[model samples]
Target: MARYNSWQNRSLIRAAEALTDAARWQDRGAFFGSIAATLNHLYWADALILARLMGNERPQDTITHSLTNPADWQDYRLLRRRRDRQIERWAADLKDAELSGTVVWYQAGGATRVTTSRALCAVQLFNHQTHHRGQVHAMLTAAGAKPDVTDLTSLG
Candidate 1:
């Protein structure tokens, strides 16, 4: 799943590179507003969720502001690419016992939230990325950028 997540992300980012700054930043009426914003949201979610998976502290407030303008796109792309590698390594090292363990995270209001299964938490991370990446794919295609095929069967 991590492999797929990383592949899809790379594909989307590569396609987004084909777009001009204006097109990348244009509002598409999606939840995150634009392709860049959607990608930033995915990166933000991944960072927070992976930190929880590794029993680490949350990331800083860089993403607490606007998602589209979270950071320079090129810089964020590099960071996200590195993060994807980390997630892949983590997934490869994951054990069955850890999958059944519980994970806890905090919400925006300092509310405590618990996930009964760590595996479910991992699943949710990929699911979250897929959901938003689908939006990005649609938006990219609408703007005539060619994102790679999302089918897992042929991806390998």
Candidate 2:
């Protein structure tokens, strides 16, 4: 699981770096309007799930609040690197017992629900990231920007 998470994080970072060209950032049709926005959303979503898994209060609003404008390539790169580190750290420290317990939390829509097993929740979080990242990838390709290889093996 840690290896898979690491691969996914590396893949995400590579995709972000591939969009360093300013022209790619300006493409309006892209997800979150640019690679930066899409990456920010991924970070936000990961943080949300991590917080919940650690028994922290879930944010009342959507993870979209963490979104920031990536007008500068350097700033966007720095933020993405920071987020990647955070995810890697979180994945490494996760224990089997923690991943096996139930996680009860309020949904963004204000409904209460309980999730069984940390592994399942972690899988859901990763899956959600991949799903949205796919949307961003398609948008990036449509706007004529080349994305990094998305295969998990290529992450290494």
Candidate 3:
């Protein structure tokens, strides 16, 4: 799944390269409002979830900042690449015992604490990526940028 995440991200970034920055940032009325915003949200969410799974401090930026922190598209791409590598390394080091454990985290924007299966957290990470990427995929296609095949079987 980590490899798939990285591969799909690379494919999307490459496809997005054909568009000008203005086009990528232009509002298309998706959940995050634009391709750039959606990608930013995905990156922020992934980083936070991974931090929770690894018992690290959450990033300082709030959800609102996700759209503008790495303001430049090029910077976003570079950070996303680094994040993908971190995820891959985490997956490689994971042990069976780790998945059986639980992960506890505070609800976003609240003091309430939540606990869930570590494995489920991992599932959310990949699932969230796929969900937003699908949005980006549609937006990209509508904008005339052809993303590569998304099949997991194509990972090879």
Using TM-score as the measure, which candidate wins? 3
Q: Total clashes, candidate 2?
A: 1
Model with the higher TM-score, candidate 2 or 3: 3
For each candidate in turn, give its C-alpha RMSD to the true structure in angstroms. 2.1, 3.6, 1.9
lDDT winner: 3
Tens-digit lDDT string for candidate 3 (3-121): 99999999999999999999999999999988888999989889889988986533333433468667798899999999999999999999989888788877665576788899999
lDDT of 1 by residue, 1-156 (tens): 889988998899899899888788899999888888888888878887888777753333333534854557788788888989999999999888888878776665455555547888888888888899999999999999999999998678
Q: What is the descending TM-score order? A: 3, 1, 2
TM-score of model 2 vs. true structure: 0.71
| lDDT against true structure, model 3 | 0.88
How do the residues 1-156 of candidate 2 rate in per-residue lDDT, one tens digit apiece?
445554554555555565546644564665477666666667677778877777754554644445564556677667656766777788777776767767767777767765657677788877877777787667666655556667777656
Q: What is the TM-score of each candidate against the true structure?
A: 0.90, 0.71, 0.93
Using lDDT as the measure, what is the rank order of every candidate, best first? 3, 1, 2
Model 3 stretches with alpha carbons more than 4 Å out: 57-65
